[model samples]
Target: MWVDLVVEEILREAPSHRHVVNDAKTPSGHIHVGALRGVLLHDCVTRGLRDAGADVEYIYGFDDYDPMDDLPVYLPRDYERYLGVPFCNVPAPEGGGESYARYYAQEFIDVFTRLGATPGVYWTSDLYRSGRFNEAIRIALDRAQEIREIDREIRGSRGLEGRYPLHVICQQCGRIGTTAVVAWDGREVEYECRPDLVRWAQGCGHRGRTAPFDGHAKLPYRVEWAAKWFVLGVTVEGAGKDHFTRGGTHDVASAFCTRIFGARVPHPIPYEFFLYGGKKMSSSRAVGAFARDLAEAMRPELLRFLMVRPHPRKQIDFDPAGDTIPRLYDEYDRAAEAAQGEAEDRDLARTFYFSRVAGDPPRGFRPRFSKVAFLIQMPTVDARRVLERDKGAPYTAEDERELEQRISDARRWLERFALPPARFTLQAELPEAARALTDAQRQFLRRLAEIVQAEAWEGEPLHTRIHELKEEMGLTPREAFGAIYLIVLGKDSGPQAGWFLATLDREFVMRRLREASAAPASAGE
Candidate 1:
């Protein structure tokens, strides 16, 4: 629904009906999962435009020509020598022929493609080398004074009087980060690579003059952003809120676009950050989960759901080490159910509709994720048989596929990210913690053993019986459930005890309960 609203705004305000929705990222290291937020945001807007019968193109650019200012900690310390060099000129970490930029860029590209977003990909290095930006570079050089004035007006910084807005690669050292264009003649620019230019990389003090075109030089970020819009004909683009703040990069770029380039500014969409553990993620700092790892850890549709369900203005805080994965699966399943029914909430239905990777949302028996997780850990239990029983019917092909995917997802979570309560291992012998149970807890377990032995019960009925016994014994829920979990899982909490026990061997459950109740109490108890 929010996507529809954004589409309406774009249609009303854009200079033209045919639109290009664009986003770009600099691949300095393993691209973090947070970058996917911008990719998917632009994607949703593109999809919405197409659905509304508007012609739209989605293009994603990799800023590969940008210099590597920060050496990622994951790389070798020797890589510090390459810090001032352009990413396109540095060697890949794995020593292949590919540039450092493309090596990491491809990893992130694969992730978004798996999420069903296939945008036309471009590289900044290619744009520069192929003369695509030659005219824009010339225009920027001729209007250097005007560009400086615009920056001063918007940002209140007036020290720049003769400095041009371009950086050339040093002719001697081949580093772009430390080179500054001091003066631009009609065709060539004088530049210097100063030793103390930046803290991250030391320059070689090289000086030269060259024509600042055809890949010889690059505009500063704010100018380059505007040039990309002019050359690419982008009509809609969104960035993080930091750039859209008062007197921020967006403000300066907008002025440069209109005054210097004589082009209409693209419609702006300012979005919030995607944080990990309450901190914004970084691509170069290795601050959050990498996009490739998250893609591998989750099903493609579920990952899409994680990005698409939240509004662009809302921040997402993800922590994989706790209940986050299980809860996300639960929310996705609910949306799927809602999408299939006409009477469900309309917003929920829209979320499910947009979250889909391809085709209609499958209609069939859907199982709860937690139960599937618990069932897979029980070595004696057939997860398929148990899920099929819960379905109360034979498995359809669609149901089987869905169950298999959930099984895979659950295993990944359990293996990598599950918290203690969500993880389970059936104790082969009476656990030591069970020996510390009070007399009342032992009495509750002894009665529960009799209930399990009396008859074979389904999950709901067995769950009901456990609650009744807890009430009858006058024990707190913790006492009643803790006793069961300690004997079976050697933990204080777990999946629904009734369904958990139903999946295990009847004899095993009966024996464990009996042993737990009869075990000698610890000396202190």
Candidate 2:
């Protein structure tokens, strides 16, 4: 169920329909699974409100205007140029990617886009430059005495040293100042580059210097939060499970909005982490899968289903196999199918799975076939061989040309994203269905391999010849179909065996089959 805190806060504190959900960065590395989880939950919460007939504008903000830390010597050499600059001022990555924050933000949006979400974007730098974020800053400044007390309390709680900076960086002018002072002074911040300090690993030369608590120096991280919440009037936003803890930042932000901004936070939902391949997807240890990689491995639509179909609060341990991907979609398809029949609670389930209404919904909220399913269906191939093979697969020159295009697209996606594991496992004790391949089935594998190699691994003629084999063997289409799965998956059940094998080249399949057949009862460790 959606948490009521944000809604309650909004009713009493914000009172207006406009509010925003702020996802700020803390000088951490790029976004990871945590960001993805947050966006998904936010998407679901906002989507739920829309379903329930609420008109809420969800705005998302990126806090890119913070400073670098004392650990600059540890960063890439380029850190010298950007270390002391407000994070947003740091230039975007070259070659058409994003700045660190923007990169992660866009990654979050990519997931949202696939799931059909459309939250507006407002960079902190942009907001500050436009002079729209200072009112909240003033309120925070009025409570300067209180903020000092809060800082002291925080220091005591954390067992810190003498004092810490009360203000945050202004992405606009790139100055560090308190939100409280900025509201009253009405002075635009002035930025100065500290390249020498940037050169030193110890500290920015100004590190321990007693810089004044100018309002410009300290940004009301919370005030900015309030301004965003007030301006965009977001109805709902979801955050990590960690943020909802008692007395966490959310608690403080909630109070700041009510006491300072005279507004409420939106409906805030909390969500758990998703574990991929038996481990929680993480980017810190540099371990975990990314969305682009997942998309490349399969299809973007399947990844969307995996993300959006689940309830916001539940945890997901995503496994590429084990029927997890298809199972989720199957449930979706089931809910959709039952929505047509008069099944009990079918509409509710369908609403949860797909959209509430059956007809075409908004583009941001539509469904598609999963890339994972496509990956499972596509023939396994040695991607390098597909790329480098001088001789083409057995096919008419025209068909070969078409197949090359598909292979090239697939390879590009794979290169950018999915990681092909080092080992392939073939079951030692084959399933009953697989154990039943007839003599004709064996001949067909050989014939198909020959056709494939001769055609230079092209697609169409390979497809056409499979049907011919089916007829020549005097076997039902179903029986003839079983052979491909038996040989490739070592199981009787799988996606279409013919298309699956066709997707892969002979070398990849041959190696995988050999590995599978040669294994002991167990596979890779």
Candidate 3:
């Protein structure tokens, strides 16, 4: 519903021509997961507009002509020599068939495809090579003074008066940023590749005069962003919150669009960036969690849900270092339940629809994932029965399939990401710790054996009995549960002992408890 509001507003001021939703990124290296947010956001808007009977297209642009400004940590130090070279023209980091830009771009694209953001992809290099940007290029060159004046008036910066707005890829080294255009004759430009022009890479220091066509030169970022809007007719786009800040990229690009290219700027969807490990994600892959890292850690649908569930303005402080994936699953299932029935919480209901991967989401009496997570590790607790009871309805085939998938996910997630406190295996024998139990602790297990055999099935009633036993034995809940956990799990604590015992093959639980109570209480003492 919120996405509809965002989309309707876009269609309200929708382009008279083809409705286009566009986003751009330069694949300097392994892209941070933060980048996927824009892909999913635009995808949501695209789906919403199509549902409303508006024709729309989503395209992701790769600014492949942009120079490699920094060496990603994953690449060798010798690769730093390629810095300041046009990314599309540079060789892949490992010397693959794909150019350097395409190599990283393909990796990132595969990641978003897994997360379900499949936008039509375009390369900015192709635009320049095809001469599609020539008109905009000539306009920017001819009206350079106008842009200079606007910059001076708006931000009080000295403008590009004598110099051209384009950076020519060097004739020798093929580096873009190190070249400076000193003169523009309206049809061609004369440039000098000064060795000291940039700190990143040394220029060949060659002076050359050439026609700026067929990807020989590219517009500066501010001009390029504006030119793409008119050339490609992008109707809606978004920028990270940093870009939308005071006098940032969005401000400069928007102004350049109106002043130089004379094009309407795309509708802006400004979003906050994701922080990794409490630090702002750096473009450098060494700093933040990457798209592939998170994609493999959990189901992609949950990751996509994370992207769309939050308002664009809200900050998603996702640190999936511990039980965060389990918690995320819990939150997604909550939203999934809210998607069905009259969920008074509107955000919950709307997010589930946006979070789904394909087809209509299975509805009605959805199980709470947190509870299922706890129940799943219990070997004997009929997981389907626990899930069905939680769902309060018999599962259809689809529901059964969904449950099995989640069970596998929960198991994998616990073994991988969750902390030791949340993980366990049902024991085959009374654990070594069972021998150390005091007489009173052994008596507690004996009493729990009776409770388990009485068919006082858990989860709720079993959970209640543990407290009753605590009161009856004059023992702390910790002491009482510790005895049971040691007997079954070889630990001082584990999942709720009562539900756990009831879920076990009743014979296994009864036998384990009997073995534990039969052990010499003073053996370890």
Candidate 4:
């Protein structure tokens, strides 16, 4: 399994240090399908590692404590009373949960659970409150000199030099720019922020200058993160592509772990964004048509199958149309049929889709009735006549009941969950022959009705009827028997017509047939 590959890589690189997947948050916001993809990827890795005989731990961190300018004071103006509080400490729904840090963390966790991904959560505020991970933060800060040198070495070795800042995080305050200089063991290091760097927000009427860039400001953030992973000792983690962009927190964490706390960087798998209606998935906006939305419309298994293929890096374009769902399932079925003797990748893909489809029927799987043939079977037609005429067995009451319930449920599920029901309607007109007098199609329909009216219904009698009709009409068994489908459904085929008609109320079916037979042909002819 790929998890084994990751574990082997980690063990080879750092045999003594524990392995962990560092799951971090991008500010608390709406959960998107893209985020769900990250969760699934992480699950794959975690499951893979355990299968490979390696111990794995999961650590999901809330970066809510990180400084965020993107948020505004949505609450009443006197918000300073909330300062020094973590993001979770903020207010409820109205404030974007930005009133406190704890509130921010819980909101997204709720969203994640809805998508079927749960992580071992460690809040940054809890770390600060407990003051337990402080030692790791202090050590990483004390070694800021060495960490910077290593960073510079790595950058220079790669023949690229960029402006890199030297700073340590403050455990007391959550800021990253504390610059107080403290010397220990013949090494000079910054233990706090540079008061000189404090400046007012550009063009803002707010008078107070910003706090200086202090190392202590970040101590709380880094120590809490590094310490959580160190103790949890996780093996795999996944994140959205947002955090991996060129220079991001991953780099900072790498330096903190390798140079400071001396732990191995866990395998980081970055996933591409999941688009909704061709746009990047966004939590704050409408969910549009993604996995969760689709799950509501179809079966859970179908949604899972949707993500089974296409590597993590590959992009997906999904449509909510019911037609697309069946096609996708067909593809999944094809993969399953061809899975034997195929490569492991192919087998896994098949297994993945199979499990997803088998998991839960979305809203409820419905038959593909939108097709012209399916429409034809919707009415009560000469199905019995066709069956008797063609020597097919008649249907038992139980069989009839079951088939009727299936059809009714299918129609209901489609009506309830399908988007824009009008789009799937087939309103085209029938041919003049089918519309005017008894088309050969109508004749067969009438034949089935007669047999239903004549005998005690049973599977055998229906089969016998279809066979008889096939012989008399000189039509292939399929061609001869298909007329019943056309007569009942106003189309060429549908759920086995004889069985369908038997299950359905006879009067309803007869009335529908009368209506269909008398109806005039439309432009669709």
Candidate 5:
């Protein structure tokens, strides 16, 4: 629904409905999951435009021509020498023939591709080397003074008084980050590679004059950002909110777009950050989960739902260590139900529609993710059979596939990120904590053991009986459930106690309950 509103705005503002929606990233390291937010956001707008009968071309660029200014902590210390070199020129970490940028960039490309975002992929290095940016580079060089004035006016920056708006790769050291273009002649530029120019990389102090076109030089990012809009004909683009700040890079770039490049500024779609555990993620710093890993660990639709469900301006704070994954799956299922006309919420239906990678939302028995998670952890339980029974029908082929995918996702979550209480292992012997239970709690467990042994009980019926016994014994929910969990799981809480106990071996349940109930109560109790 937000995407539809954005599409309406873009269509109303642009007389020419044809648009190029673009997003790009510099692959300095393993791209974090946070970067996927921009990619998916752009993709959503692209799809929205197309659905609204506007011609749209979505382009994703890898800004590999950018220099590596910092060594990622995961890399060997010796990689420090590679800092300041253009990423396209550095060797891949695995010693393959691919450039360092392509190696990491391809890894991220695979992730977005899996999410069904197949944009026109391009490399910034190729654009430069192929002379696509030659004209823009010349424009920047010719208007260097004006560009300087714009930066000064907008950002109050005074550092570019004498320096031009370009940097050349040092002829001697091959490092781009430390070189500065001092003068731009009609055909050639004078530059210097100063050793002390930056703290991250040492320069060779090389000086040379060369043509500043055709990959020999690069415009500073602010100018390049505007140049990209001009060269690629991008009409719609968005960046993180930080860039759209007052007097920020986007402001300076917008000024350049209107003044220096003589091009209309692209429609802006400013978005918020995708935080992990409340902290913003970084690509080079290894601060959050890598995009590819998260993609693999989640169902494709569920991952898409996680990205597109929230408004672009709203921050998504995800912590897989808790119930985040299960809850997300639950929400995604609800949206799917709405999409299937099972609910009257149009917004939820729209969310489910856009979250889909392909085809109509499947219609069938959909189990709750939390239940699926619980069932998978029980070694003796047949999760598929249990779910089929709960559905009151045999699983259709589609239902089977869906259950299998959720099972895989649930197991991965359990292995990597599930919280302690969500994880379970039936105690081989009576847990020592059972001795701390109150007498009334033990009495409740003893009654539960009798009910479990009296006759065969399914998950729901057993669950109801557990609640009845808790009331009969005058025990609180915490005490009643705590007694069962303490004996079986050695924890204070777990999945629904009835369903959990019913899934276990009836003999083991009776035996653990007997042992726990018969144990002497703690002194305080």
Candidate 6:
């Protein structure tokens, strides 16, 4: 909602050109799902800008020119030798089809595209190689001292402190981290490739400075942050909360923009990220959910909905290991229905509107997520037929497609993230857990077997019948359900027992219950 407020303010200011919003990330490893937050935030902002009558374009960049700072465990130990090389120049993993940068960058791009955030993708290496960044390099060198002062003033650094804003790839080893610009002669830079400059890679100790042009050298991150705005003329962008802190990269870059480059800095929309299992997601650490993981587990619109429903400032601690998927689907469904009706909360309804995959979302005959997930796992049950009966009508084409997609999503979620409580397999015979039931529980099962043979089966009515039998047989609801689970699911609990049993073949349900009701007799013999 605040994004709307920001876009409205920017609309009033009215940039002279198509409003440019940009986001960039270094493909240091497999891109984490947390990175999607920025992609979604910018999409929402760009849409808001367009709705507010501003011409807008969104560009996403992979900073492949950045040096590899850390290697993930999946890479070979020999990859350490390339640690300080530009990411685009490094080799991709064995069997990966492209350069290291393209491998991971393309994967992440596919993810963003599927999530409905269609951003113009630019690899920084391409910009440099194509000479697009040449002018920005010149600007950085000409304003080197001013840029250094802004950094020093903002970060409270003493002097230059052995830091130069420019890094030249070593002429001998082609490693960027081994060299630092020692002096500039107004044209060529003087530098040394020291062996001990960084821990990841050793330099050849060669000392020579060529013209830092045409992909030869790059500005350090903070300066480049400012350089890109001047080069691309970005008008609206958002950064995570990390960059908006006092004297952080955004502040320093804003200062550089005002004083050195004479360009309007990108408007700031500060947002937080999705945390994974209570910690920050880092691809290099391989500790958080990857974009690929989410792609496999969620439908595209549902994945987009996860990011859209939360306010930009709130932290989402997602545990993919839990029931967050089904719960999210339930919440998303409620929001979709509210959006369809005359509504009280317009912002929430607007969120549901934009959260769709594309075009109109499915309408009519939507099944509950939990129920769909439950029925898909049962081999003997035709879930579609059951769902149709439950709906009291056949599903429309769109509803059938939605049901199939939900089945795929539920299967993926079960395979990857289902906890013990969410899992159950139908028994081949009565389980030993059923043999331990008391005589009254066994009698309830025998009576339930008769009901299974006689009652017209459906979720609600059978559920009511179970309750009635619970009262008639003087059994607690838990006790009554426990017998069904132990006999059919081999546990003391499972999916809502009546609906679960209703989904199975009538003969199978009757036979399983009858076998369970007799388990104690065989045990005594």
Q: What is the C-alpha lDDT of each candidate?
A: 0.88, 0.49, 0.81, 0.49, 0.88, 0.83
Candidate 1 has a TM-score of 0.96
* Stretches > 4 Å off in candidate 4: 1-19, 71-85, 94-118, 145-234, 245-252, 282-302, 321-324, 327-350, 353-525
lDDT of 5 by residue, 99-215 (tens): 999999999999988887889999999889999999999999899999999999999998677889988999999999899889987799999998987788888998999998899
- Which should have the higher lDDT, number 1 or number 6? 1
lDDT of 3 by residue, 47-104 (tens): 8887788878999999999998888778889887787898898888766757988988
User: How much lDDT does candidate 1 score?
Assistant: 0.88
The best-first sequence of candidates by TM-score reads 1, 5, 6, 3, 2, 4
Using all chains and alpha carbons, the TM-scores for the candidates as numbered come to: 0.96, 0.57, 0.91, 0.57, 0.94, 0.92
Off by over 4 Å in 6: 13-17, 342-344, 446-456, 468-477, 505-515, 522-524
The total number of steric clashes, by the backbone 3 Å criterion, in model 2 comes to: 37
Clash number for candidate 3:
1
* Tens digits of lDDT, candidate 1, 188-217: 999999898778888999889999888998
Put down candidate 2 lDDT per residue, 437-498, tens digits, no spaces.
55566565666555555654444566677788778767776566666666555545554444
Predicted structure 2, TM vs. truth? 0.57
The weakest ten consecutive residues by lDDT in model 4 span 200-209
Q: Where does candidate 3 stray beyond 4 Å?
A: 14-18, 155-162, 342-345, 362-376, 379-395, 435-440, 514-525
What's the C-alpha lDDT at position 314 in model 1?
93
Regarding TM-score, does 1 or 2 come out ahead? 1
Better of 3 and 4 by lDDT: 3
lDDT of 6 by residue, 7-106 (tens): 7777767754589999989998889999998998888888878776778899998999999878898898889889789998899987685789999988
Q: Residue 77 lDDT in model 6?
A: 88
Put down candidate 4 lDDT per residue, 134-203, tens digits, no spaces: 5554565456566556555543332112212222333444434333334333233434334343331111
Between which residue pairs do clashes occur in model 5?
Answer: none
At residue 353, candidate 4 shows an lDDT of 35
